[model samples]
Target: MPRLADKRRAILRGALTVFAREGYTRASIDQIAREAGVSTRTIYNHVADKSALFETVIQESAARVAEAQVEAMDRHLGGAVPDLREALVAFARDHARPTDADHFALVRQIQAEVGHIPEAALDSWQDTGPRRVQRAVEAHLARFMAEGRLRTADPHRAARHLVLLAAGEVTSRSFHGALPLPAKEVDAIVEDGVEVFLRAYAP
Candidate 1:
């Protein structure tokens, strides 16, 4: 018999697939159960309702992605950055694309169904994922400012700008990773973005 935790994970993964493919408006518990290889009754045993399930799936998925992003931030900016531009470029490249294809598919679905999604779910997603990653970058940027590697500026704003400039172009151009861009193109975008960021925040 599968462990309870394994069943729960299977349910979430199956729910994510359905939600990503069908959006919240069209996904059904029956469909999720089929995808998850579980009985409908089993899903009900775990979640109160569809709304609760969606909330849980998105928050869990976001946390997984954010964990990777925070690690990328630390890898790129956690130590002495001899070349800020190079460091930013590397970080941006590392994070420029979706590491988890299924998660981004859900993200695309969320964007499409934002108007219909529960407010709490959306808020939880942001807090669990993007905001957490932003805070990590903000902390690193603050340290850079203190080190005089970057000109003194609003760390929060600088972090936002850095993310937008560094990774936004690729994400936007790729349509949230639905369309893949070439490596050279991705590198070009990251390089240009890092250059623009360095110019804006030069000491």
Candidate 2:
């Protein structure tokens, strides 16, 4: 027999697919149950209601993405960055391209129907994902400032600047990965963004 945890995982996965396709207002428990290959009662046993299930799905997905981003930051920016601009460019390019398409699809769904989503769920998603990644970037910027690589300023603001200049640009152009961008265009965006960031922050 499948473990309860396994069933819950299946339900979450199925819910993500349905939500991404149907949005919060239209997604039905029956559809989610079918996608999950479980009974509607099984879903009820796992979660209290649709809102709770949506909250769990988004938070879990955000955490998974945040963990990967933190690891990427550690690998690219956490250690000895001999060339700051080069390192930033590399990191920006990596960050712009996420391996998980389904998660971003859900993000699009959220964006399309933001008003309908629960405020608490949005807060949890931001706390679990974007804010955590931003904090990681802020810590790295703080270290760079202490080392005299960047000008002395607010690490928080610097982190935001770097993110906006680099991956933020690419994400805007690519529509959060819904539209595929060519490697050359991506590289150009990263390079230009790093250059602009360095112009402002370089000591």
Compared with the true structure, all predictions reach lDDT values of 0.92, 0.90
Return the TM-score for candidate 1, rounded to 2 decimals. 0.97
**lDDT, candidate 2, residue 177?**
90
Per-residue lDDT value at 138 in model 2:
93
**lDDT per residue as tens, model 1, 1-203:** 47999999999999999998999889999999999999999999999999999999999999999999889879988877888888899999988988898899999999987999999999999999999999999999999999999999999999989889988989988987889899999999899988999999999
TM-scores for candidates 1 onward, in order: 0.97, 0.97
**Cand. 1 Cα-lDDT:** 0.92
lDDT of 2 by residue, 1-203 (tens): 57998999999999999998898889999999999999999999989999999999999999999999899888999878898877888788888886778888888889899999999989999999999999999999899999999999999999998888888877877778989799898888888888999999989
lDDT, residue 56, model 2:
97
Clashing pairs in 1: none
- Candidate 1 residue runs with Cα over 4 Å from true position: none
Return the lDDT, model 2, position 121.
89
